[model samples]
Target: MNRLKPFYEITVKLAELLDQDINAKNRETIISQVNLLIEKRGDLLPEVPPPFTEDEKRVGSDIVLLNNKIQQKMNALFIDLKREMKQFKKQKKSNKTYTNPYEKIQTMDGMFLDNKK
Candidate 1:
C-alpha cells in the first residue's frame, strides 16, 4: 500500500547503512535513525495492514540478509576485540613481572626462637 512506502524506503536505507564500513559515530547515528523509523512504523501498525506485495517481500528478504551479515560482522569484531584484550592483559602482566620480578618470592633464613619458662 502507499502507506508502506516510507517504511520500505527506511528499511532499504537501514540495510544500506549496515553494508557500509561505519565508525562508532556513524553507527550511533544509524541506530538513532533506525529507532526513529521503528517508532514511526509502530505508530502505523494499529490497523491490520494488507499482506506485503512481491516487491515488499523481496525488500524484506534483503533486510533479513543484511541483518544476518551485520550480525556476523559484529561477532567477528567481538572475537577480535576479545583477542586483543587478552593480548593486552598478557602484556601488562609481563610488564609488571619485568618491573618487579621478586615481589612474590619469600626468603627466610633458618632461625629459631625459644621461650624460657
Candidate 2:
C-alpha cells in the first residue's frame, strides 16, 4: 500500500501538467481529490504492486523509460512554447509542426532496447 503512494502521486503530477487551460479543473482536480482521499483513508492502497514476469518487466521498464522521456520532452516543450509564446503572444498555425506526435518517441524507445543488452 505504501509503495502505491508514489505511483499515484506521479500519475497525479502527470495529469496536472497536461491541462492546457488555466481555468480547467479536470484531471488536476480529480487527481488531487484522489490524493487527498488516499491521505485520509490509508487502507485503500494495494498491499503490493503486482509481481512482474520477465516480459512484463521488459514492457514495464519500457513504459517507465518512455514516461521519463515524455516528462523530459514535455518540460522541454513547455520551455520552447514559453519562448515562442513570448515572441508571438498568440497561437498561430505554423507551417512546420509536429505532424507526428511520435517524432522523438524513437530516441527514448531505443534507450530501453540498448539498455537491455
Candidate 3:
C-alpha cells in the first residue's frame, strides 16, 4: 500500500462524511468520525518531496481538492451551528420571560428615597 493511498482515502472518507445531513442522530456520529479521520490523517500524513511519479502527483492533487472541499463544508457547518445556538438561546430567553414576565424588571427594593423641599 502506497503511503499516499491511505492519506488520500482518509481525505475521501472525510469529505463523504462531511457531506451527510446533520441531524440529532447523525451529528454525534459525524463528529466522531471526523475526529477519527483527522487523527488518522495526522498520523498517516505523507511527505512526497522533489520528483513525483504521475500517479503520486494525481493523488496529491486529488487530496488537495478534497481538503479544500472539507474545509468549506466544515466552515459552513460551523456557521449553521452558530446560528442554531443563537436561536436556541433566544428561545430559552423567550420561555423564561413568558414564565415570569417581571423576572428581569429593575426593582428599587433596598433603596431609600429622600424628598427635600
Q: Rate the local accuracy (lDDT) of all candidates.
A: 0.66, 0.51, 0.86
Candidate 3 worst ten-residue window by lDDT: 44-53
By TM-score, the better pick of 1 and 2 is 1
- Candidate 1 weakest lDDT stretch, 10 residues: 41-50
TM-score of each: 0.54, 0.32, 0.82
lDDT, candidate 3, 1-117, per-residue tens: 275887888899999999988876677778888999999998876454447778888888999999999999989888888898899999999999999999787768888777787
In model 1, what are the clashing residue pairs, if there are any? none
lDDT-superior candidate, 1 or 2 = 1
How many clashes show up per model?
Answer: 0, 0, 0
Candidate 1 TM-score versus the reference:
0.54
Q: Which pairs clash (backbone N, Cα, C closer than 3 Å) in model 3? A: none
- Candidate with better lDDT, 2 vs 3: 3
Better candidate by lDDT, 1 or 3: 3
TM-score winner among the candidates? 3
